[model samples]
Target chain A: MRIGELAERAGTTTRALRYYESRGLLPARRAVNGYRTYDEDDLRLLQQIRTLRDFGFELEETRPFVDCLRAGHPAGDSCPASLDVYRRKLAELDALIGQLDAVRTQVGAQLARAELEAGAALPGGPEPRCELTHNGPTD
Target chain B: MRIGELAERAGTTTRALRYYESRGLLPARRAVNGYRTYDEDDLRLLQQIRTLRDFGFELEETRPFVDCLRAGHPAGDSCPASLDVYRRKLAELDALIGQLDAVRTQVGAQLARAELEAGAALPGGPEPRCELTHNGPTD
Candidate 1:
């Protein structure tokens, strides 16, 4: 199949296919008519790349899985290299989720504090409590 | 104060300040000697920007807070516009966190499945169970 057909079958774009080829990921052979050609095996490789990509794996990180498929493995994760990539990705995702969770907590606190202050400043609002003098005698 | 002093006071780099200036988020006035000048107000604005940025807000998202500070508000979130930005950011963060959580679940499942299969395929592994044969032969 040509680049377009391959991309269509893989549910991707020709530009993306070309990009993968440029990155030496999914190299295609030139047909006798001087057009890029791909076989069913190439389609399988493209599907593997797309699956990993849809799983939020970076293009670079998908290399090992692609290589595993090219090496005739039963599945991408059947290879140790692909399994290592999966482990690293899992760790990266865990760290990112932790950071985002921390940021969410801080931002939520800020929003709540700001809203409370804003509400307390409105007309006919409740009198503000003096925390500094909460337990001290007022002079 | 010069750009270097401003950056040092803000706990950021002069390069970052210059980049912010380029983005028109923190434009600095020029001194008589053709050097950039800043004051305490600029430091406050920079701090507001930095705090929000550290909260995972994009530089562009921090613009409303910076603008609020520049408008002489008591705090960045003191303005309605800044509050609106906060609401939008909270929504964006929530959506992102949800997506990351979904991805994390998927990646974790994939890893678990792959590890189980890998372990099952090890040499001298337990004899494979025949579910179909145990249930009787297919017609």
Candidate 2:
């Protein structure tokens, strides 16, 4: 199918697909009319790439997994590299969580001030304190 | 004080201070020797800016806050624009949280799959009936 079809099927924008190709994350064989053609493997790879990206793996970091998937899985061999990637990303995620927590505290303060001035309770009635905001994951 | 001392006091780097200035977040009354000096108010403002940035406000978004702050409480009474900025950013934060939540689900799924493979678990786990390999937020 066409780029638009591929994008819609993949649940991503066309621009993002173009970007993925440009970043060498997804390679395409150009058609005679200069349009990109994607096969079944390409579709699967795109899904995998998007999955990793949604997990907050940077584009560069997801390359290894893409390479692994593309290379044909050897029976029962551990993707140690993929595991290492996750471990490192987990550390980064922890740091990101800290940053988010800081944002949350500051935003809470801002929200409180807004609520005070508005003379009403916030509509959300206390949001979850995630990695980007709020110190209390428990809260 | 020197840029180093100012940055240390501000809990940021000299490079960041320079970047902030370049980005118009900070204004420097440059010294004859090409150094930067920040008075008490500037120091206080720096802290506020950092706090706001930590809260996910972009540098430009803080302009009205700085204006209101500089103009004092009476100024605060006059400017509704800052409130607008705050509201818009709150909306942005909500969107960001949604994006991150999607990412979190992706990570969680990846973690589960890796665990299942490593532990030699059966191909099918007891069903919560999970499958969102590329689907939108399972949440």
Candidate 3:
């Protein structure tokens, strides 16, 4: 089928298909009229790309899986390169989650501290603490 | 002090200070020569904005803290509005961490499954499993 039909069948946009073609992720066959065309195998490749994308894989990261499929593997993950991409993606996600969690903890602490200070300064609350003290012995 | 001095003290670029000014997070005074100037208080506000930004808060998100400091609060986070921003940031961080964690789990699972399949299909290993079966065995 043509680009539009393949995009429609794949639940993606023609623009995205064009971009994939530009990136050489999904190269299309040209008809005698110079129109881009795709076959069922192309649809399967597109499906694999979409699934990896939905899993938060970057467009570039999906290349290994696409190459694996084009190499005629039964599944996109059937190649060592695709498995390597999966491992790298998992590590990146883990590191990102760790950083975000640390930030969340710090933000949470700041919020709690600020709220407590605000509460203490409210009208009719306990008198604010004083830090002044005599250096020498008091009379 | 002039914009240059403020930028130097704040460890940021004049361009960033100008951007904050454009966002109205920091409004500078004009010297008699028409050059933008800032005071010690503006330095405090800028510091607050910078700290929050370093923590991944959006430029817009730093407004309440800047406003709180401008309103004569002891700290940028002293006002209720600042506390509100903190709460919102914490919630945003939590939701983001959750989503990333989910994706990480999925990617990890996919990697493990793929590796296992690759292991099972290694050359010279046990025969691949066959799904076909006869309804009855010959007596």
Candidate 4:
């Protein structure tokens, strides 16, 4: 199949396919007519790359999975290298979630403090009062 | 002080200060020597911008805080506009954290399933036992 057909069948752009080729993630063959040719295997590799990308895997991180598929594994994650990438991604996500949660807590605290201060500084806000003359109602 | 001095005191780059000026967030005054000048008030605004930025606020989001400080509020968050920005940021963070958590769960599940399949597909993986010869132990 031609590059355009492969891109259409894979639900990706020819530009993206070219970029993958540039990165050597999905190399295409040169046809006799000097056009870029791809096979169903290349489409499978592109699909794997796209799926991992949807899972937040960086383009480079998808390399191991692509390599696994190219090496004739039944699935991308069938290789130890691909499994290592998955483990690393899990760790990276955990660390990012932890950091973002901390930031959320800090921002929440700051917002609360600022709101209180703004309220207290408002015009006609609560003021300390003397109760010497109103002692009968002190209770 | 000149732009350099303000940048140094604010712990920011002159390029950043210039960019802020270009964005009209921290416009500096021109001196008789044709140099851009800033004051302590500008420094306070810059500090507010930097603090919110460290808290993951976008450069544009810091505008309200800077405006609040320029309006002579005790702090950036003393104004309704800045508080609005805070509220919006909190909501944004909440939504983002929720999405990231969902993604994390999905990636973790994928990893777990892939690992199990890979283990099962190992060359020497578990095989069905032959119990026909052990009829006496079938109970």
| TM-score for each model | 0.87, 0.62, 0.86, 0.83
Error of 2 at B84 (Å): 4.6
True contacts kept of each: 0.48, 0.06, 0.62, 0.52
- C-alpha positional error of residue A76 in candidate 4 after TM-score superposition, expressed in Å: 0.9
Badly placed stretches (over 4 Å) of model 4 are: A126-139, B126-139
RMSD of each: 8.8, 7.9, 10.2, 12.3
Give the winner by TM-score.
1
The sequence of per-residue lDDT tens digits that candidate 4 reaches over residues A1-139 is: 9988998987778999999999989888999989999888988898888777766778999999899988988778778898888888888878877877877787777778777776676676763322211101100
For model 2 chain B, give the 10-residue run with minimal summed lDDT.
B71-80
Model 2 vs truth, CA RMSD: 7.9
Docking quality tier of model 4? acceptable
- CAPRI tier of model 3: acceptable
Write model 2 residue lDDT over B26-128, tens digit each, in one string: 7877789888877877776677666666566677887776776676733221246777776676666566666665565556556666755755535655423
Candidate achieving higher DockQ, 1 or 3: 3
* Model 1 residue B58 distance off true place after TM-score fit, in angstroms: 1.7
Per-residue lDDT of A7-28 in model 3, one digit per residue for the tens?
9998889999999999989999
Q: What DockQ number belongs to candidate 4?
A: 0.27
Q: Rank the candidates by TM-score, best first.
A: 1, 3, 4, 2
Error of 3 at A81 (Å): 1.9
lDDT of 2: 0.66
Error of 2 at A32 (Å): 9.6
Best DockQ goes to which candidate? 3
Compared with the true structure, model 1 gives a TM-score of 0.87
